[model samples]
Structures are given as structure tokens and as C-alpha cells.
Target: MSNTDHLTALKDKIQAVEDGSIVAITMPVNIYLQEAEDMARCARIDIAELATINVTEVQIDDLQARIGACREVQSLWVEDQHKANQAEDLWADIQVQANELKSELIHTFRYAYRKDEHLMSAIADIAEGSTNSDTIQDLNDLSVLGKGNTDALTAINFDLTKLDTAADIAVNGADALAVANGSRQRGSDTKVLRDKAYTYLKESVDDIRAAGKFLFRNEPKKLKGYTSKYWKKRNQSVKKESDVESEI
Candidate 1:
């Protein structure tokens, strides 16, 4: 399905399921889905036997559709998440550079206004806040302050073009930061949708597993097909760690 169809199905499924746990997503989505697919295949083979509990062929087809929706949504979510992460990384680097330049310009402003109390107070206003957004605004403020008092800066041998650079950095950094924040929000939104799709799928999977477990309870090999190997190993590892901690 196209991403739009996946997203639409995601919304509908999310509305259809209102009580799924948001936690215990222990394994990666890809690995968990692979195990689920294996279990689903087993369930398909034993579906006739699963008739006692009403796990019909219709349910199996529904499970497959849910899986497809999840796979497509998962891919989109991962792409958005990667973009958000990259944007955040770039923002951090840009913030560092902007802060460094801000520090330089603030120091220069202080030196240029050292003998003038009125102008020093202006410098104080420009240097008030230290947040990323505040720092970007300060760059703009400093550029204006420097240009307005170019004579004093020139007397201190300041290059005029540095003011232009400060103004440009302020505009560039603000635009980049805005884009980064928007990307992060998009990633967060997509993650919630993906979780909903997962839950919708888990409902079908667990229902089928419940039936399979009951049908194959007398046969060990058949019973194993209904279980989750990924979760079993994860639970075992957690229990082992807990045991060691208790011993300590």
C-alpha cells in the first residue's frame, strides 16, 4: 500500500483499538514482525484446527493486511525518525557555532563600550539570555548594536563585515532550528501512529495464538509454533539479570 493508505488505515486501526499498552516494546519492530509472521504462517496451516475458537481464514487475511500496513508505516516512521535525528544533530552543531560566534561578538561589544555606561547597558540587554533561540536573537541584536556604533568598533579595529556575518548567522540558524523542531514533531507523531498499527496487529496475532495454544496443548511441537521466541529469549535474559542482581 502507498504511505497515504497506510496512514489512513493506521488512523482507523488506532481508533478501532483503544486499550493497547504503549510499553514493553522490547525487541526491534523488524525482528518482532518477523517472528509474528512465522507464527501467523503456522496459524494459517492449523487454521482449520483453530475453528473451535473462531480463528477463521478471514482473521488470517486481516492479520496479513495489518502486517502490510504496519510494514509500510514502520518504514515511513523510521525514515521520519532518521530525518528528525539528523536535523537535531545538525541543530546541536549549529547551536555550538552560533554560541561561539555570539561569545566573540559579545566580547567585542563589551570592549567597544567599556568607557560608556549607557552603551554598556545596551550591551547588557543584548547579552541577557543564553538559550538557543535567545542566542540567535542576540546575534541579530548584536549586529544592530555594532552597526549603530560602527565608529566605536572601528576605533577598536573591528572588521565591519563581522556584523553582516552575525546578522546572516541569526537568520540562517533560526530557519534551520525551526525546520529541525518541525521534523522532530513529525517523527513523534509518526511514532504514535506506528504504535497504534502494531497494537491492532497484536490483537489479531494474540487471538490466533490463544486458539493455537489450546488446540495444540497436548502436542509440544505444535504448541511451540504458537509461542514467541523473541519474547521468550528476552524474558529469560531479564530474569537472568534479575537473578544475578539478587545474588549480589
Candidate 2:
């Protein structure tokens, strides 16, 4: 029911990736936030050099804004995932009952329409697929088919009210599950925007690091502040493991 057009719009404006690969968070988001904070701090080392490339105080403020957006959206994603999970459980329960009803209708329809070529063909089409979505849609199709051919059902003493029940079940279940599915879909959309925000922040951080590294090329102490300690440790840890593997 909730509109996700805004989320889609935000993601498009970011243009994070051309290939559309917004996946699991690459690192803990807290680390990304801290990295942004540290980058912002180091950018102050030589604001003049950064300003030469238009990476001004306004850009720095925007970087913080992007970080804040990522943080807020990340919390909302957690809530959405929980809601989706609950809906999935409800859908599973409803599907079991729906499937049983569909099977009952199939067997009865075969008997009621066995002598009629046209009706049998319609029944055949309805009995085709084997998925939850198929079950939901079949209920709708069956309701229509049943109502249009009540004379056939009446001769067989079929309960016409079941048609109404079938139609209600189909409509209600489909509407509920559609919203749940929309929530599931919004998961990726939310991540796309969240991931794009991180990309935006990292781009600024990289810009600041590049300038800082170049400006402090002659000063090792200031240069340390320009680089990512997280990556430095990770690389060292990885190299240590590789060295042990080579020794083995």
C-alpha cells in the first residue's frame, strides 16, 4: 500500500552503479560512518588544497548528510525485513488452505465437465501450473469459470456458494500477499539507496584522501591521517594469512 516512488527516485538521482549491483553491505555500516567521520576530520588538514578542486565545506556538509541518510534508511530496512518475514509466515498458512480448496475444485470440475469439450479445455488450462502464485490465480479463474457454467454445476449438485468463497479467498489473499511482495521488493530498493548513500560518502572520502595524500606526501605523520586505518589493518591481516599459507 505504501508508495516507494520516492525511494526509487533517490536511488536514481544517486546513480551509484551502472551495472545495478547493490548487494549486501560490504562492511559494517558503523565502520563506514566512522570512516566518513575520520575522512571529514582529515580533510581539514589542508582545506585550501581541497578547495582547489571544489571539494569545499559545502561538499563536506553534504557528505555528512549522506551518511545520516544511510544510517536512517538502514534502520528502516531492518524494520521492513521484520514485517516481510511476518507476512511470509501468514502467506504460508493461507496457501495451505488455498491449495486444498484448489484440489477439491479440480477433482469436482473434472467430473462436472467431463462430457463437455469446451469446459474441459478451460479446466485443463486452470490445472496447469504448480506454484503458490498459480494457486492464487487459479482461484480467481475457477470462480469465474464456475459462475458462468452454473447449469453444469447445478446438474452435478455442486454448491454454488463455494464460488463466492473461492472469489473472496482469491481477492483477499492476493491483496495481502501483493503488499507483502511489495515490501519484499522494497528491500532491494531500500538497499540501493542505502548503498548509493555509502557510495556518495566514500567518493568524498576518496577525494579527500587523494588530496591529503598528495598534499602531505612529504609529511609521514599527516599522511597517516589521510589513509584508512580499517583497510590498512585488513590488508595486513590478509597478507599475514597469505604468508602462512605460502609457508604451509
lDDT of 2 at 199: 69
Tens digits of lDDT, candidate 1, 1-248: 55457456556756565545654565689987887788889888887888767778888877777777877778889999898888888788888888998999889889888998988998898788988899999999989888888999999899999889889889989988998999989988778878877887787777888888888999999899988888789899999999999999
Query: What is the C-alpha lDDT profile of model 2 across 110-188, one tens digit per residue?
Result: 9998999998999899999777778889998999999998898999899999988888888877976887798898876
- Whole-model Cα lDDT of every candidate shown, in order: 0.83, 0.76
For model 1, give the 10-residue run with minimal summed lDDT.
Answer: 15-24
Predicted structure 1, TM vs. truth: 0.88
* Highest lDDT model number: 1
- Pairs that collide in candidate 2 are none
Tell me the spans in candidate 1 whose CA falls farther than 4 Å from its real position. Answer: 1-7, 15-23, 235-248
